[model samples]
Target: MRTRGSTAPHLWRPYTQMKTAMPPLEVVRTHGARLVLADGRELVDGIASWWTAVHGYNHPHIARAVAAQVETMPHVMFGGLTHAPAERLARRLADLLPGDLDHVFFTDSGSVAVEVALKMAAQLWLNRGETGRSRVLAFRGGYHGDTMGAMSVCDPEDGMHRRFGGYLPSQVFCDLPRTRADIAALDAALDRHRRELAAVIVEPLVQGAGGMRMHPPEVLATIARLARRHGLPLILDEIFTGFGRTGTMFACAQADVVPDILCLSKALTGGTMALAATIATAEVFDGFWSDDPGAALMHGPTFMANPLACAAANASLDLFAGEPRLDQARAIAACLADGLEPLRALPGIADVRTLGAIGAVQFEAPPDLTVLKARFLERGVWVRPFGDIVYLTPALTIDRGDLDHLLDAVASVLREGVPPGA
Candidate 1:
């Protein structure tokens, strides 16, 4: 979707093929689930800022909390200073999660959160004098983040980092769990390579950003058990599925599985500001509690616990506790499941799947991403498609009417076949 526009100041976009990417939309304002363009047009956000703003943009509750915290103190170096918001958020998260997952390490984003998880896992093994455990085991059809360490574990066939394959560390990939046979294979692989593996990373039930793939809860439970049995750290990258994006408060909770390390971000701040946390279990933390300074987990982001982000996160969590966010998510999921059901009969579409607030339509053949997206924009919806998948993950606050509009836009585009000149 190319567009001619008045030029603005310089900026670069991530994951964009700049040579052919569409002109960036200049969003001037946002409220609820809508984006207000510079031209005064409104486009309902179909993916919730890539699934971050679960409560929607410019949410009054989150905005007020962030404002209050900014006035108090925007940020302080977390190394020496302790703040209430961050502490509250950590404790709140620990209380929300199950098991011995009681420690929280703050970071600036999801990618860094994954990095911290990997680092913690490696350091934990090293602190125990087990230095051979450096490799991470991740499943195929998984994506944690874009950072080099995170990318190293993503599905190599996803082609997100094909060019950088040689530079990234080689990691083990287990087949995505589907059948009982697949579980047998996964167990065999883990058992065979137990000594070389340091951590087992997974995206839990839903693998966002890797074509928004999803699997059964049993798969995650199996991975968690296998990791524990192998004495390997299990890291659930819930950056996309945490905060009620996957029908549960955390996707792993649906399986009643507890991981040793959990990476959380995206919706942690209700999409207000960038903040992430790599939470750990007592065992992982205790591994670094020795008197040896070098055995410690030494990673920390400068804005580890930015007060504004923490305040927004607190308000978001408060909303989840006091409001009906989970109910809203379930409603959104039902809406998507019913709304996109018709698309399965479409000629180009091969399958349609819905989970929580996320709905994906996979094409039998790859659709022209740029042209399809242009048509969606023309229909006043902000739906982004990549490769052979077109997905909608609207804010939990989006009404049935707005969500229908978003779904209908995708259906209309599929019906019209991208138009004559789109």
Candidate 2:
């Protein structure tokens, strides 16, 4: 049997340099907002399982739903047949979302959902007999996903996928429109590239995994307006900022803007399991509706609309409907502001900002992540810092004590000071 502190040698970790990186810790169990390690020590989960477990780990509602679903039906192909869980989830999502976003395409992960959205955007034009509209206009600091179609639209020069620039197809990139000049430049670029542009994709408010960069709601509104003016479909990558992460149920709501396509995952199943959805507006869906089967969107994942995942997502939506999740997110934002904002004056800390349930403390320069991670673990918190930023996206249901503990641990580590060198 594998022992504590020793991950299986054969297993490769994501975004890790195996040779020098620290060994992965063995988490024996999780409950609420805490992780129980193999050696019996508990650590407050500062990132909420990569911002998925909004209602905390192993919530009874989601667990019970999954258990019941497993007994009745575990797996089924969504290619030809439809299941109650998937159908119900689709309806729930359509009703919950703003505008006419009434269509849902299920996928197994966030990345694949993004790929599906991109496909829909591209194919929408093709089905309309419009050629030369193959490229997408994506924001500079945006991150759609790791899949090929999604990667093509991500930030090309500075994004994590830049290493694959030689392999991936090129897409137009622009900064999020912030000022009048920026908006005008974006408008000019859209007009210049109107012939080749199929869609305009962006991360509504917060650009997660792209340095947690943020833009105001007005910026999003401006982008949406420009896309409408150009008669181009807009795609919103809300996989990270959806479900109360940015204070509203959906980040697009803050701007009163609805996209033609919206990708969602992460916290869709309350972080209990993998499930994702790519929803489209009525206008986008109409492009694929025809007598010719060739007009159909031809991509489908084998595990599309897995019954178990759908059940979990349905239960997660129930929690959102029944519980005060939006209120919880607001509370978290206030708490984060109170706890982390003071650290801005600390040496080495460049900026501190909070939105809804998210908080970030960016350093002037990249600190020694390995040393900082060790210090956080020693202080009994699971805080992962990457590339000059130490951010928090804890579970919305995390109790004040644990939340305070997480903030305190981060403060203690900063007080000790980050070691020089990356």
Candidate 3:
């Protein structure tokens, strides 16, 4: 059992060096965009718990829906059993998404969703007996997840998975679209590797975890066109950019293109619980529809479509359906653009960019994220920095005052440099 101010040595933390790290903060409660610490301090959550909790924490509607579901049923085997929550959420998502991208398959989290997407794309060829098409194509600055398949395609120089280079599958990578929105190099690369390509996958508008990189809409449009021209499947990983994070419900809509497969998670359940979904077009689903059992897309997570998660997701989507979600997202984007504009001129800052509710400030040199995050925590806010970037993915429900507070905190930290004695 955990007690106040106790740090469990047994727990292993991800992306942490551990040896020199401080004990993790103890959070006792969360409501709206604020986190209540055991020490009685309240900190505004700037990253929204890794960009989830879009509707804010402990939303009444979502909490009630989930509680009601827990009373009836929490989970059941998804292989043969059917339930109301799963069916309802699936339908809601089908309607919410654009085009024939309607068929939804539930998973436990975003990384698993990416795994499912990779499998779905790979099986598209295997189902058709085209065994030669085994490789996948990805753009530079793209990041999918921590799963092995997802890691194989992340930016190679990104220090996280570079050490495991020999163990991962070799995927063809293309350069970021350069001047004149030209992807002639991309086209040539795809053509050169056409015979072995199974699909072309990317994070549509904004690349999360991989430095919050932004790409032009025209570049995204051209990617879809090239994928279609190459006769390969296109999978857009919108796990981080979905649910109005990129100023749209889905980033693909910005380019007016529909992908063969779409991965969603993080904010799917309003940050109430861990859940993810992989939605595909009918055309992609049809490829695996066969009499041969081996032709099926072979993947299923044990807790797939838990009722509580589905209920939370259903309520979360309901809020989006009835509320002025796009307006809120636009307001956030506008605020971020206006507020962050001044940072680019600051010393040691490389650039700043804002998309929808997302804002990023990249430093010319690496700053200790742990130290910087602690600095933000001291100012009663939570903002995690990685690599050369410190960014915010605040809840869309955050008011202008709180939003300004977060920006002010970032600016203050940059100006003050590291704390006096830390």
Candidate 4:
């Protein structure tokens, strides 16, 4: 086993080892949308710590709820016993989720949630005597998670799955249908692989980890229609797009479509605790409902439905009621869109896309603004540059001052140059 000290230097870094890379930023403390660095400087959290901290840092409501739950019952085995937190959370989620996606299966993270959804979809077909349908369909440039099942569905061309090529299962990759021709290509691909395909999974409206790629809701509606036409199960990985990230509580809701199975996490616990849920419709759940133990879904993590995570999720859900989070998200989206308008005229800029609280500015590699990443960091903002794409995915609770600071930092970076040796 690789000890912490033995592999820490190589494995614990982000970006790269040279230029635009160093040890991870040492955060001494955080509150709201600001991070207190070990050097006593505060930096606005531009990426929301990989788009997870929805309510930002140290949210009182979430903190209180977690503390209260921990004081009552810290941990318990969820196999044979039940808890109020878990039951209530499940009920709350059922109420929020569209249609009959009421059955909830808990997992430790978004990757596990994707794994659970894929397993359930595949086994559902197996239980129905359609064992030949084992292949999965996913879009090119789509990122589900780092797990094996997720890697199978993700685009291996992205370089994350290169080392795991031997372990990943064969999955059909379809072109992201940006235009009519692209959509036709997808239809053709599906027609060619329909016999072996079990399910078609997508990130829906916005592909976050896939360089914040934005797609119209109509495309998703088309995908849903195609899935239904082919009798293939559709799994929507809303782990990053859920909880109003795409201007809707769920991305599928925006398109007036629901999937056979839905994966959610990241913001489910208000970014307080790690929790993921795979929701399925009654018909899909029926496949696993059997008297024979072997027919049941034979998968679950040890801390599947930890009560503390459930409590945090419950509290996070309550924030949506009466707080106008969706409205706030819309306002922030508009603000970010307006803020990024200037970058469109900048040289070497390719595209500027905005959806809800997310905005991305793509630039050509190795240009004048190529060093904008280091500049933004020097200006006290932690904006991440995926290849040449610079994006802002701030917490919904970000104040106007912090938002302005982030925008100004980006503007300065585009205008000036990065600090010396940054």
Candidate 5:
């Protein structure tokens, strides 16, 4: 019911203080690696629409699948019925993921997927008659999701969820391991809190939404090892790092570590639809396989596995199987490293880091984001900087010229020196 040239004043956006926030840009349509505005101007999408469109915007394969599915069945209740799209996607994911991550539970978004993972961890203990194991052990720089349960596991002191610390369930937190001593500290902490913990959760390699922080694969391996040693389930939140975003298909794979539970979303549908899947190992699933119906996982979302969304996800998997996405990711890493690393020498620039397709330039302090955001748009590119960093997670299929243009815009903006402010 939207009219042309309408601003849609009734619509509210996320993470914005509307009273002071500027009007958002109106996008008319999207194609491969670019967004066409209402005014017909094209801007290179620097973050792939929040890192979801891995196959790029309006991909033909995904579009065709969705269109066909809509004509047949747009949606159906998942409570009592079943569908082919969901069934196929679950089997496909079970085959794709590492180890025995063989069971798939669908949800509408990443946050709910995370919420389900936490619930599974908690209930897994309760189902086994082990009471009082309710808390989770999380990391300091990790970001899980926005739901209350997910927020509880995010970086407690320094994360965006800090204000809600008093209201959420308190979970044990430890700094990400870096050295032998740090590992010892984590080992000791695990031993100290093992009795209260139901699971150990982490964002495997890159802690997305927590300032784009990057830690080594070895650190992730050590955490997994410690969790196993403590006999606690490990939950890997791969919502931001899965589906080739971190060079390899999954960040944990870089360390050859597998988790008891894994959460996936974002590029699951190639950015065409909203969908997420929480896959668990047989061990975790078996915890609920009892004759007692009271022990069953009683949570379910209204649109747990919409047929259209599942079709899009299945089509996305087809592309991954047919394309050289990993190679493209490696190429993007090289380009990002070559372009952003030089900014480390610039004044006020604290650090520059690149992993797989993600590139970040951290400032000694956050600049005026309102001004910086407009500047990027004016330069015919789209980049949204948050916290103390301006980063890029462009589509893996972006052409070399478009990628260079995005890098040029970022470099020019930083070169001119961003004025220090919020």
Candidate 6:
């Protein structure tokens, strides 16, 4: 393996190109939706640090809970042994999740949670003696994560896994139901491959990383009905849409549809620590409930259900209940949407989409992100532009003043162009 210094600049970058020259801003500290840069600049966080940090950075409740758990027991292998925190968190999640998704399988991140869900779906088919139903189906412009199985279900046009062409598993993709034609195309595809389909995975209501495209709840309900009609399981990847991001506790709640299996992450631990869970119904769990060990769901990470993460999750649920975070998120989303209405009338704007606390403004052409990003930064607002689409996904705890500042920055950029050095 090459040394760290010898690696290419782009190899370890989180997202986008690192080799392409861009100005760097260092954040040294953060608290309650504000970030303090190492250069003594403070700015409001618009994207919530990649759409996590729901309760904002360094939340006292989360910090205290995590610290207490660490002091008691930092970690333990979850394969066989059990812990109180994990059990409590699982029970809380079961109570909060929409339907009978009672079982929880924890993993390190959203990517691994997706991998677990896909494996469970395939194994469920196998246990039901439907070996022919091995192929997985996902929608175009959907992004799950970066793991191999997750990559297989994601849209190849996303350009994340182009280099690993042969490494990915064979899967089917259907167009997102943006129009009648799109829905018809999906039904046709299902008719063509229903016998071979194992599951249909979707990022309900809104597609996050795929430029924040929003679709109606009716489209999701249609897909759920089709899945049931075809005897195929449905998996909802609500890692980004969960926890009040979609104006409801879960986007599926709004549609009155429930998936056989659901993937949750992102704000699961109140953005305090990395934690993800794949909750499934008893029927799905029954597939692995056999005396024969080989029939078991033989997949789990070493750090599954770590106590510290579990404690943080439990505390997060408490905060949600005490503060009514979902209601707060709804109000904030409406405010942001109203504030952004003027952008729709702007010259270069292509579309403005909003769902709950997430709003996006896509331009006809890719703006000079370098300049636009700098302008926002200079204005004490930290908003990220995904290519041509500038989006806001602030924490639920964001103050009204900070939210107004964020909107003002966008307004300034639209009117005067990017500021100097931006």
- Give candidate 3 regions above 4 Å deviation: 1-6, 180-182, 418-422
- Candidate 2 residue 222 Cα shift, in angstroms, is 0.4
Per-residue accuracy of model 5 over 79-176 as CA lDDT, tens digit each:
98999999999999999989999999999999999999999999999999999999999999889988999999999988998999999999998889
Sort every candidate by lDDT, greatest first: 5, 2, 3, 1, 6, 4
Ten residues in sequence with the least summed lDDT for candidate 4: 1-10
Compose the digit string of candidate 3's lDDT tens values, residues 170-261: 99998766554358888888899988999999998888888899987887888899899999899999999999998889998999989999
- Candidate 1, poorest ten consecutive residues by summed lDDT: 1-10
85, model 6: CA deviation in Å? 0.5
Off by over 4 Å in 4: 1-21, 366-371, 417-422
Model 5 quality (TM-score) = 0.98
- Screening candidate 4 with a backbone cut-off below 3 angstroms (N, C-alpha, C), the clashing residue pairs are none
Worst 10 residues of 6 by lDDT: 1-10
Model 5: how far is 332 from its true place, Å? 0.7
lDDT of 1 by residue, 52-138 (tens): 999989889888898888899998999989999999999999999989899999999999999999999887878888768888889
Per-model TM values vs. the true structure? 0.96, 0.98, 0.96, 0.93, 0.98, 0.94
Cα lDDT of model 6 by residue, 357-419, tens digit: 998988888788777887787789998886578899999889899899998888878777532
| Local lDDT at 36 for model 2 | 99
After aligning candidate 4 to the native by TM-score, how far in Å is the CA of 141 from where it should be?
1.0
Which pairs clash in the backbone of model 3? none
- The superposed Cα distance between candidate 5 and the true structure at residue 201, in angstroms, equals 0.5
Q: Where is model 6 more than 4 Å wrong at Cα?
A: 1-11, 418-422
Candidate 1 TM-score versus the reference = 0.96
User: Per-residue alpha-carbon lDDT of model 4 for 1-422, expressed as tens digits?
Assistant: 33233324445443443433444567889999999998898999998888888888888998999999999997788888999999999998989989999999999899999999889988888888776778899998788998889888877787456578778898888877778898888888888998788899999998888778888999899899888988888999999999988888998998999899999999999888789999999989998888878789888799988999998988888888858889888989999988998888877677889999998887755343335655777889988776557789899989999999998888777655332221
Alpha-carbon lDDT, every model: 0.87, 0.91, 0.88, 0.85, 0.94, 0.86
